[model samples]
Target: MYRDNLYRMEVPSTMPAHAFAPRNLNWNVEQGEAQDLAHGLEKSEAQALVFVSHARPDDERTKALFGFLRRASEVADVMIEKKQQSSWDAIIEALTPTLPLTSSRVLEAKMLAQAMTKVIESEDFARAADIAEIGHFSSKNPSSQPNRWKNSGLIFAIPYKGVDLYPLYALELQNGAKPLPIMEKILGVLQEKDDWQKAFWFASPNSYLKSKAPKDLLKSKPQDVLRAAETEAAGVQHG
Candidate 1:
């Protein structure tokens, strides 16, 4: 019961992969569920099963979570349920297999960007459009945002502490677009949250102009990031 004293609120907007205070789900925590949880816990099975959380990266809860999972993975074959917190005990038991340590919060985002070779801003779609895609299209041929922005996708949320949170960004596409398993693709992109320029470089290197990063962007200023976005927008050509 690591409940913090401060009040928490959810960001109000349409985010593809929304992160919020962890909301506990009520279920039997029955034997079947435990087995299922254990099965899904196998990290080696998937490239990575990232946990997108709202917990401050430096929070004690983050450390606790990592420690907890590492311990669990070590004893994955054993039924050492008593050591786990009641809430997570159920999740661990329900896991289907041995899992890898999850990359949480921004770390998850950064790793996902590396895996997918793309980036996600974690902003609402509209904000993403504001900072990333610039310019307009003809009404007869209005441009559509990537599919992930238009819909939600495969994602998992773990308790950052007492709160429920998830990845901020959903996925869209690569520069050299190829279809991904819809859910994995979503998971892949969600992993890329908040590293838009790097994502672009990785996913579709050809889409970016490497010659001159806006000075402000190189300095990691917000306005400069927007400048880079506009530059990207102006450069997009529908062939």
Candidate 2:
């Protein structure tokens, strides 16, 4: 009886046009629940189907997700191809001698400078009032006025483009516009280097300070940061 009924049933393609027409499907899938089971194959498929039913072609979130997935797939392909062809150690051994130490340092410096430029452009720097803004001129004389702040070592200026930007982190404002005790010590250690180099020293992550940048640790652990700066200075001096 079941086989006879099945034989009598009409095929989907042969059904009425309205019956075969695509129907709007809606699924009330919660984002948090879907995310929780995102890694599970069955749950992932269910989530995908839900998205497919609701997601429009022009959806920005869907576009970004697909774009990211595409890039990730491309990177995976490149990595897999490289792994199959040659090991990283073998490749490094082949290319290492061709690249000189000076060349490597120059490349590293260029990359670091580019990274620093991004940070500076993003306005992530601490607010430090300039000489004119601070209004602390020693005399009416223009020449001597600029020298007052420069000579005191109270502020270190980083030269970006044509302007000099001073980081305010070196100052202890709570103690009445005075320089932090360790600031002078750090400045002394980094005195021989240029302004940008000094900025990099303070801003770059320090291995001695457990990967925290010196500028960040200056307030909490100034002595330890200063010690690290001194060690770096010693290396620079000896090297």
Candidate 3:
């Protein structure tokens, strides 16, 4: 009973002066200095790390804590509820842009976007709707067929301006508009890579193929294209 009582007793709120005072003082001073350095707006660039001292108990408590933070600083609040299932949801919610982008960064982005738009909107790339209309895919949801093909790795799509556009060369126009015969093998070589990387490999000139872009020879010389993809994949692995 005595041992059980001792086990249940609360820890002392204070420690001996010699045991932790020096360490506590040092830690407190360092933490204060870090906060001062991070939050000093007079610096050319400053960033701060803020956190709640304890786990919030409820939605109202969470909201109240964030509200206090917003009042204290120029912060954009993202109130996460207990019921949310994914960590990504909270992160995405926190990152959702609350203001329009401005300055030279915005100008550079706009220029890049215009250049990409010119290429992505060309005849080389077409949306699912266009392919469905031209290829006559036998499905109720014609627009979804290309996405299904992309998911299966029979073909890939590039994302531009919030829309996915498929390369027209990925399909065979002569034979029931099925996926290009060699694409599966090429995609296999570049497996686990993102769409943009795969797209870049197709668009960029390859020295292995005598400086010809892979897409240009995909129909005329599929075996050569496959070799080029293999060589690129090998280089990426080794280099």
Candidate 4:
């Protein structure tokens, strides 16, 4: 006696004739429909649903999308914060100490100093110091240190909210409270210009100096730096 065995097929048919063809997704048609629906929507209804998408935080696409959406929303108070200092602002800040003593100059110098401190901290060039510390380092009386450095042209005694701050890199400790020789020469070259212009010249990188910043090169290559400064000063004179 033989028993007939029966089993239900679990697998789907693999025959091409039995397969269903995939329908092509028409993105253009769907997008048009979405636009139509959005257009037909009331302002309140549209505002009720915000379709937000995000890209990488630093991506240009994300920034563009954010700008487009921000403009589309007619947002007047939305502020886009700048993460890096502009070249012009950096120059102005560097020159702040050179301006005539004034209340506004003090405030600007303070803000600029704070900004520069952040940058210098990152670069590890030199630590920024308040008047007292700079005075201690230079072995001068704390109260009159700013005046001493300013008179000697050793440092820019940047006035900040009724106080003075100095960038430590400006002075050469190895040589008895002396200003960097190059700085003195550069200052002489820049004597005719306003503090802002002089500051810009010192801080900005020069192609002639192989893109080295004048302030940074003051110690190692004073002569070459001084020549570059003279060239710049001449250009300013002739122009």
Judging by lDDT against the true structure, name the best candidate: 3
Question: Against the correct fold, how does model 4 do in TM-score?
Answer: 0.41
Q: List the RMSD of every prediction in angstroms.
A: 25.4, 20.9, 16.6, 23.5
What is the per-residue lDDT of model 4 for residues 1-239, given as tens digits with 9 covering 90 to 100?
A: 22221111111223234222332221111111233345444332212223333333445664575556545443321221121235446777988876476898899999877665554443323223343463355434454655665677755544434555454555676544545656766777777875435555566789879998777777788888889978987998999
As a whole number from 0 to 100, the lDDT of residue 170 in candidate 4 is: 59
- Report the lDDT of model 2 for residue 117: 87
Error of 3 at 29 (Å): 48
Q: Scored by CA lDDT, what does every candidate get?
A: 0.36, 0.59, 0.66, 0.52
Query: Please, what are the lDDT tens digits per residue for candidate 2 over residues 1-239?
Result: 11110001111233235432333323222322233334443433232322221355455776676556445544553565556456655776888777456988999989987977865874534433444335453334433433455577755776666656666666655544445678777887788988778877777789999998888888899999989988998898899
Residue-level lDDT of model 3, residues 73-151, one tens digit each, is 3222112222233555677889997887779889988876765665565578888877887778856777688888889
Candidate rank order under lDDT: 3, 2, 4, 1
Top-down TM-score ranking: 3, 2, 4, 1
Extract clashing residue pairs from model 4. none
At residue 198, give the lDDT of candidate 2: 80
Off by over 4 Å in 4: 1-143, 175-177
Instruction: Report the number of the highest-TM-score candidate.
Output: 3
State the lDDT of candidate 1 residue by residue for 29-141, as single tens digits: 11112233444444323233233334554577755765565555445423433333465767768886876666576687787556543222322223323313332323333
By summed lDDT, the worst window of 10 consecutive residues in model 4 runs over 3-12
